[model samples]
Target: MISTKRVFTSSPFMMLICGSLILALALGFRQSFGIFLKPMSLDLGYSRETFAFALALQNLVWGITQPFTGWLADKYGASKALLIGALAYMLGLFFMAKSTTPLGLMLSAGVLIGIGLGGSSFAVVFGALGRAFDPSKRSLVLGIAGAGASFGMFAMLPYGQFLLNSMGWFGALIVLSITCILMFPLSLGLKEKKIPLKEKRDTRAALTEAFHHRDFWLLGLGFSVCGFQVVFILTHFAAFIQDHNLPLTIAANALAIIGFSNMLGSCLAGYLGGKYPKPYLLSLIFFLRAIVITIFIFCPISQTSVYIFSAAIGLIWLGTVPLTNGVLASVFGVQYLSTLSGIVFVMHQMGSFTGGWLGGMLFDRTGSYQIIWITAIFLSILAALCYLPIQEKPLNVLKATMQPIDKA
Candidate 1:
């Protein structure tokens, strides 16, 4: 006799472990990218804007490709997508390490790696998990998986800096390339069958519904602010700190501080997602992020200020993720969760493009980051207001057709 309890709990735990490890590596390595900007630019003789554009393009590519990848994961399985993503990741890093020209850097870093990240990271992984876990446990499981990314960001920031100092940018990238192969085996653990009959719905209908939904766009718009706020900090905050005549270590540690706090915060947020109104919680997070950014920028700049800001920001960093997922799951059922969220992610990445590319361009034009920092604050406030109007009820269509067959 198959013990459903054992099967559900044990299998989900294993999948979480595997999914968490894979995401940790993917997100961690990607998050540490800022440390290489100065070194790569100096070595290759490119302007900061040029490098920033490549990263901006990368985010855009990731956003555009996410829907397709999410669809693939939902249709086939995450393992196959992970397999392809791993190859692209390794190959992209290899080319990035060898590239000596700007175009080559864009192709390797922006296009290929973007493809790799889209397929192997959170969307594909959690999309698979969505079908495996019970609805009651879904958000919590997603939250646990989301925390893995924060852990990666925390663990990789300092190590990436160390690699830059010891091995140089090219050598560091090569080492990272080699480390990416672990995604294959780890991804296999996520190869799960769909949960016992939940709902069988047309993916197209789901897409059509979401496109027409008011709150869907609201969530998408709000998420874009999150993308803008986080990416601007991740891609440029270190350099901003370095420009202050502070030690590079302070910048790296500052990022790590955000990572550590994000891990704790993400876990807590995931737990809270199960118990609270996800939209309200999400609004609270955005409001808190705005407050932290405002305080840090207002106070005198110092090592102490930087660390405090990082810690405060980290507490709310990826906290929005589980809440975001929770909202989607609540609003739209799980059958098409991955694809619907993928559409939302596209908006988020557009914001990422603006944040990453615009930051570099502004600094190049004005020689200051103050404007961009202020922009992040205003956008955070705007996003907070946006989330307030979202209704978290299940879709009306799902309500209509979800009843069981007639006895006759």
Candidate 2:
């Protein structure tokens, strides 16, 4: 018989490996959806806006379900939640393969896959990693796990395009379904952490308290911008490149560049989060994004410009995940991390919803993505400003109440 203690207290390296594998599988399948948009629209005679709406719905649904999924992951543990998520994700892909109408696509891609992603993506996996490691090493481990998503995008996005070219969109969906299902076996390696039956605080109260905290709101708002930037790029960057009269391979290569650079970005962010103030680092990232986007938009459109822009943006891509979660742990503590982080992620998803759909809608209406790019640049500036004023002190209700008295 295997030892339960050993499972619960596995080495950080072992935990990182398991978490990374799960993240790579979940994110790999999720990233491939972007590659399907144009092909699916052409085959089904759907407009870009129609597909955009479905992807938007997927983001919204994912956002709405994240809090609940995180709550479940916190209460029951990540293993079972991940398993169920994998099953749902696979089914969604299968159903997406059969979709002939926009409604069917919405149901499969938007609702089903959204819920699946909510339960299995970074939120759940990072929460598990957070629990398994000590505070000192948590950010590094989380960073490593977060890179799995970037690696997924690097590997799977091109692979998805290849699959589409080889087998067409329908066959690609079937293949993706098989790939998503593989997450199940990897999830089995994740052991559930034991929670005491009666805790000092219940999940509901924790969420309630987190909501009332001003800092949580700031974090949520800041995170929303991250979501908007990432989702907009992920959903439309390839198409945007194609619109510039560039080859599809150029678009694909740009995405791959982002993924490649993001690997280093995530690792560096993790190391920095361990030593510096996470919020300040986040502020710097947002500020730099604004500058980068502004420069890219104004610069002449060329293959070289695309590569430079992609590499710059990719470096900051998922770097937000580590700092965001690290801040949550720093302020709120790990006891309620999954739930609290879920709530923050809901805001992120809301931004994602807007970013994905709005980019498509604006393009359809104006025949240009320039406006959306400008909006992203503006929001990045705003996010940087917002982070500048945030106080990164720990959450201590008693200490907060005693502050004036202590000062007196």
Candidate 3:
């Protein structure tokens, strides 16, 4: 017989470690793409806008696929999805090495990698984790898992830079393809527990019901803003730093600082998410981002100030993932968390698509990123206000349907 006490603690810890590692590999490799922008553009004779559009397409495709990927994770299991994602991710990297034209980069880096990320990223991985842990421990586990991305960002940025310098971009991509293979081992630990056939049917019904609710739309809209802010910074920050006449190392270090600080931020956000209202926590995060960006723009540009802004911004970075997922759990039961969260993530990716592409377009047109930073700050404030009216309660339809009807 399975021991109830042992099941609660030990299994979850094992899952956490394994999940974190997989996340590290998946996110770390993708996060390093910014380092390739200049080199790839120079070699291929493509404009920065062309590269940006491909990356934008990547984000858009990922966003478009996320809901389907989430549904697959919810219906089947994360292991199968993750395994498929890993293979696709590796193949994308391999093809990226051989990419010679804009179209080649679009298919390899944009579509394939985007699909790979949609299937393999936190939407699938943490969705599984969300189901594994109870509500009490869910936020904490999600936070730690989210931190894995930050860890990847921290380690991979400089490592990617080194690879670029030592080996050419193609060689660096080959190395990353091998690194993507590591996710396969991590996938082995994510086993799905069997649900009763009746429960499975009800879960599907619940998901359908959630789609009819207005709150879900609001939640998705707010999540899109989070995606926009993060992707914009991640894809463009390195270029932005370089534009300022700062050393490339400064950009690398800045990305690393964001990753390093995000570890603490994600953990803290997770802890607080478990204890507080997730919507409010999300609002606070957005509000703080506005403040951080404002200060970053107004302050003098120096290595010290850049690092400080990056760290401060990083602390709030991806902290939204835990809370956003937490809110989904609060509204919809964990049974369909992956699918529902995936839909929300799709909206987030829409924002990501805009941010990545627009940052480049604006820069190319104005020869300045100043306008984009200002726009982000304004949107952050608007997003903070958007969360104010969200009711933390579950959808009324769910409560009504789940409760037994009274007999006359």
Candidate 4:
């Protein structure tokens, strides 16, 4: 027989650890997609815009579907949803290897992988983890998982390079496809914990409350800038480094530095979120990002400078993720955490689509990335301002002013 008491003691933390490993598997491989830019575009006979557009589509599709994915995770079960997502992710990677045309690439890499990411990435797992822990510990749990996700970025770049060098890109994708199946085992651990929505409001009532909240939109807008800045840099920065006559190894190492630093940042942000206001932490992160980007661009391009910039930016990279979701959970509660957080993340995706597409389009047109870099600075400052006015309070604060709904 199963001991219910034993399950309570170890399971939540175990689920958090398992969720972290799963996120590393999903996001680590996804992060390395940037490394494929030069090789894939050249080999496929496609322009940078074509490749960029496909990735942009991927971000858009992920954003559009995330709410539904979150709803599924909440209503059915996150582990089941994750299992399905892992299969789609593996299938997407497998077909991406065989794709010869823009259409096939877009469908496989953009649509299928996007759906896979919507279910398997931090969005789904964080929701599951949020429910597993107490509200006070939510940020800490998220940070641990966020650090694990960041570690994927830390570990995957060099691994991807090794595979690229030895097995070739197609072979690398095939291997990665097989790697996606590992999520099934990890998913098993998450099934032990469940967040019953009956104790909280229904999905529609939560959605209705969130959509009416001013802070929700403000947070979403700020998150949009977060997506824009990071994805643009991730997608194009290495190529930009090469354009400066630096070594490819420098670019790769710089990326590794960013990832390595982010693990610490994710954890720090989580700790800070528990004590301080998450919106404030978000503002500080964006403000720092703007400063980092401005300095990196105007200064001389050298290997040391690249590493410094990478490390500085990396420290703040995914720090916002835990804090952002932390803020949402703090104010609204975790019952519909997945759905609400996913809705907010949609803004981030829209920004991702814009940032990736704009960088490539402007590069093809102007033969430079200066304009987009400047635009990022402007957006960062704007985002910092957007988070300043968010009122971090419970959704229950509105309960007195509104009608009660049947949670059952």
Provide the TM-score for each candidate, comma-separated. 0.93, 0.94, 0.93, 0.94
Candidate 2, residues 1-408: lDDT per residue as tens digits?
Answer: 111211254565776787787777777777667767787898899888888888888888888888888778777777777888888889988999999998999999999999888888877878778877899999888888888878988888888889888999999888988888678877766666673434466676667667666667778898999989888888888888888999878888888888889988999899998998898999999999999999999998899999999899888889999999998887777766877888899999999999999998999999999999999999998998888766666778523742222212
lDDT of 1 by residue, 16-92 (tens): 89888888888888788888888888878988898888888888888898888888877667777788888888898
Instruction: Rate residue 176 of model 2 by lDDT.
Output: 87
Q: Report lDDT per candidate.
A: 0.83, 0.83, 0.83, 0.85
Better of 1 and 2 by TM-score: 2
Clashing pairs in 1: 28-152
Residue 268 shift from truth in candidate 2, angstroms: 0.6
Candidate 1 wrongly placed segments (more than 4 Å) = 1-10, 194-200, 397-408
Indicate whether candidate 3 or candidate 4 has the larger lDDT: 4
Q: Write the per-residue lDDT of candidate 4 for residues 1-408, one digit (tens) a residue.
A: 111111222388788888999988888887788878778888989888888888888888888888988888777678877988898899999998999999998998899998899989777898888877888888988998999988888888888878888898899889889888899988888774442322444677778888876788899999999989888888888888888999767887788888889999999999999999888889999999999999999999898899999999999999999999998888888767888989999999999999988998999999899999999999999999999987677877755554444345
Which lDDT tens digits does candidate 3 get at residues 235-276?
Answer: 888888887889888988899899989999999999999898
- TM-score of predicted model 3? 0.93
